[model samples]
Target: MRRFSRFVCIDWSGAVGEHPPGLALAMIGQAGAPELIAPKKRWSRQAVLEWLHGLADAREDILVGLDLSLGFPFIDRGSFFPQWDGSPDSARSLWECIDRLCADDPHLAATSFLRHPEARRHFRHAKGDTGDLFEGSIGRLREVERHQRVSKQANSWSCFNLVGAGQVGKSSLTGMRMMHRLEKRIPVWPFDPIPDSGPVIIEIYTSMAARAAGLPANTSKIRDLATLERALCVFEADTPAQLDRVDDHATDALLTVAWMRQASTVPALWTPQLLTPEIAQTEGWTFGVL
Candidate 1:
């Protein structure tokens, strides 16, 4: 029998009116099942680090998916700031967090935030023959749009829609930090568009759906929430599992607030994909199992 692996998908977006990236986290594993977690937003770097620390504590084998640039773009490594305290409207704390973790972990020893690399090479979206976000069904396809073809650009340029004029650096730094953590083996990168033998895609929209109905984070009444959470374990043939202590009420409330607040502008921002058994030997994925 083939062994199963679990994955975590972390879809990151910058916080509103702040340079810090907003994150969407998903835990996928055991035959392609996915478990969605509560989303969080904070202005403090310490808060970001603490959140990651908590995740690390919860599941050490989790593969974290990040959607930010993970390297220093225009400066030397030594001159970059260290020991970020999250004070005075600066990204120092965030940078420092990445620096320390990468420094301590061998997998993350590749480099620091001083220099960044491209993540797309490791992942690509499914595009149809006409070259659109592939719908996979081929029948009288529509013409391609001007923006359909993706090209490489600076992280700052890519995230210009979120970070604004001066925050590209933050995007790059955050990406570097995320990769560093993954490289250190503390976390794994599972955001690749292609499924991996070790990870699976995360169903982030379910959480939003749960929040829409005002269901409890851990309730028996919300059938959707229960199904979604259970879907996280469907891929596994073994490990029947135990009931997780989920606060369904809280989850519903939070998702409701986020949607009402117009967080839907970027629905894809909340969706994440995990590494799965299929991805290890192949590059395609289907939604039938996990």
Candidate 2:
């Protein structure tokens, strides 16, 4: 496994506003516990992009885990949207297309992209407003998500469903925009081969990292300082100096960072049995699902 100077986790949001409270960032250096970065301000997608660009500029050796899907399901139906001709064939292309369509959107908001003709046909909107090409009940699961289900880990929400608390549609699309913009500076795992050095981003299900700390699926959230310490102890990580638990995002990112450090050393995690070259190029894999 390649050693990293830091491990970071970003709990992203797809909300319409300039800065979303749901967006959170946390990181741990080579020698200390995980700490939230800029915990005071409501983070805008653009701010997160600037932060990542700074890290890339510094040539930092870090493994960043973003809590959002990198790409929609492509392999299951041979293309992300089989019926539509505009569907991107690969993850990088998908990000590029999303970024292009949402270029005018402020704070990297993807609502504009959702208004696109093809997008409206593939995603389920408000009640009774599902797109014609939207797949089954929960929509199509990416290959990694299917394997996640088989392994009894965190099963991801379909990027096709744009409604409900469980749906990650908006968040994933917005994050895809960030990925597209960051790719030139920072490499995204699977979509871009694991780089020899510098920062690399990977899709992560917070539940998977929480599970690594011995938390069950039903109680994956770590909201209080005590619970946060308990999870960190599982990795023998030091307790964070800051103890603000205003929301679950802080602790979730903290636990994820500690867990990511441990998971990064596992050889099998880097190469899951179910991950294929096609899947890597199309629907990217989550970091700790294996």
Task: Estimate every model's Cα lDDT from 0 to 1.
Answer: 0.32, 0.85
Lowest-lDDT window of 10 residues in candidate 2?
Answer: 241-250
Q: What TM-score, computed on C-alpha atoms, does each candidate reach? A: 0.32, 0.96
Q: Write the per-residue lDDT of candidate 2 for residues 172-226, one digit (tens) a residue.
A: 9999999888867888878777778888887888888788788888888877788
Residue 37 lDDT in candidate 1: 58
Q: What TM-score would candidate 1 get against the native?
A: 0.32
What residue runs in model 1 are displaced by over 4 Å at the alpha carbon?
1-4, 16-21, 39-48, 54-59, 72-169, 175-290
Worst 10 residues of 1 by lDDT: 139-148
Deviating ranges (above 4 Å) for candidate 2: none
Residue 177 error for model 1, in Å? 5.3
